[model samples]
Target: MGKALIAGVMRWQNTLDLTMSPGNVVAKPLEHVIAANDANKFIAYNNIPPDIPKIKTKSNSKANKNKC
Candidate 1:
């Protein structure tokens, strides 16, 4: 009975090791490469001119004009 218990414990340990092994970890660099490629494609397809001027306005101008 003791020998059977030891064998069962060893088998369970092996199973745990297999399930938690680092060799089963996913490759992160491959994911980064895929993300960068996707970003490049997205930027290429959605290109907008960079020289456009942005509108800037003061918020209190309307209240000051109303008081005048």
Candidate 2:
């Protein structure tokens, strides 16, 4: 795992136990960086270049009007 993937204290105290979501701290550390993406966000926006025109539909044609 990359340095960014590992953060905070190596030891666990009550303060380090952030977030109520339960998880294991004993996970084996990886030696290499891993690649990941937001699957839902990727599928929704499709990584399309912003300059490309989108097909305007009834529901989305005015989606950007409020930006102005």
Candidate 2 versus truth, CA RMSD in Å, comes to: 11.7
What digit string (tens of lDDT, one per residue) describes model 2 on residues 1-68? Answer: 21323346665344332223235242222111121433323222554544468776675554546545
Candidate 2 displacement at residue 40 in angstroms: 10
Cα-based RMSD of candidate 1: 18.7
Where model 2 places Cα greater than 4 Å from the true spot, the runs are: 1-42, 45-53, 63-68
Superposed Cα deviation of residue 22, candidate 2 (Å) = 13
Best candidate, TM-score: 2
Candidate 1 residue-wise lDDT, 1-66, digit = tens: 112224635543212332333453433323443354534422222233333454445732344455
TM-score list, all predictions:
0.14, 0.20
Top candidate (lDDT):
2
Question: Model 1: clashing residue pairs?
Answer: none
lDDT of 2 at 30: 15
Candidate 1, run of 10 with poorest lDDT: 41-50
